[model samples]
Target: MTTLSPARALPSAAEVALARESSRTLSAYLQTRAETQQIEIVDDQGAAHPVRVPVSALRLLVDLLTEIGAGNAVSIIPIHAELTTQDAADVLNVSRPFLVQLLERGEMPFHKIGTHRRVRYQDVIAYKERIDVERNKVLDALAEQAQELKMGYE
Candidate 1:
């Protein structure tokens, strides 16, 4: 079997099901729209006249509507304070290389200005919280196992 690379993302199993459902709803929506409700043409005011478009293109606009309704649009995280990825890594309590690995793996959000990547203070907080939560879960399990084995405690 052939596997797609990370860059060549086809929908995940869940997303594929959602897309199929979206297609059905889209087909229904197209059927219910009036001809005039389908599309509006626009023009640049300098000299050129407006252009015509097909109702088929209406699907493009509505697709974004669905994505927005589904909470799939990019979330705008406030960056009241910003730090370099290395600094954010420190805040995250991980090595700089590990933070870079997260960025490269698309697990972290950052913006590149020139060549430097900056992460928001809020993102740093959230990342730390996530790691701490997972760490605590593992530690809890380890404690339970230690109790069972009668080790590490008197």
Candidate 2:
């Protein structure tokens, strides 16, 4: 597990709470893309990049930012595409911890940058496509049954 050191003099509880109450969604955890802050990250290919992020994604970025400010999260924002563990989780509509399980199970490919892990956009898309195919198959079976009933009482 990665150890995170809390930043000094970051946003106060009142400030975060106010932000939370305003958004009333991510609970100050995430803001809109335009409103959220920027963060930098490095990809598996050893390339540095910057990532423009929304609030949910930016929350983690903010922590990473305050940890190693400037050249840290904000600097690497340029290379962000299908990035971040939480973003992958968002794509899958599951928790980040669960997505980490998928990564461990070899269901998704991810790479480690220093202590952080990053997931690819294509991998999430492929997983989504796979799920859609399975769901379609079930729907098709039900449709076939409906067609049979339409033909007769069976």
Candidate 3:
């Protein structure tokens, strides 16, 4: 299991409440035309500052807030960051041996730094995207087959 140091702390009740409120507000905005435009950030002193962020970044922010609102700890890692084999395996939710096998098979890219193997965060994310696509395809095929067999609800 992963362990956090003393410096890492969970969000307080008030913080969680704010996160939940922000999540709801952001979700509502994201579902409307407001999502296509930039947003303003208000400070604790009621000072509003306008900033334009990429839609993808805003989406990520919403996800983070949602998780935080649900009392989950969040970590933001840069896409170009290098991770150790164990860290990469943890990110992929696989065993180190399995990750090594994938690296050996060229399914995921990795490089050696001195005696240690490092994997790019982007590479792991790309692999996850491919796996998700493949899984969805198989699921769709199965649903089609089931429909042809007149199984389940209409």
Give the TM-score of each candidate. 0.45, 0.41, 0.66
Clashes of each: 0, 18, 0
Where is model 1 poorest over a 10-residue stretch in terms of lDDT?
1-10
Top candidate on TM-score is 3
Q: lDDT for every model?
A: 0.65, 0.64, 0.83
Task: Flag regions of model 3 displaced more than 4 Å.
Answer: 1-14, 22-63
Q: Who wins the lDDT comparison? A: 3
Between which residue pairs do clashes occur in model 3? none
Comparing 1 and 2 on TM-score, the stronger one = 1
Query: Which candidate do you rate higher for lDDT, 2 or 3?
Result: 3
* Tens digit per residue, CA lDDT, model 2, 1-154: 2222232355555556554444343334453535665556789998989866666565654455453432232223222354678877866789999998998998878899888888767777788899899999999898889888896535
Better by lDDT, candidate 3 or 1: 3
Which one wins by TM-score: 2 or 3? 3
* 29-127 per-residue lDDT for model 3 (tens digits): 566454355789899999999988766677888999998898877887787788888888888889999999999999999899788888898899999
lDDT of 1 by residue, 1-66 (tens): 111122223445676567656656655657644553332345665555544445556576456545
The local distance difference test score of model 1 is 0.65
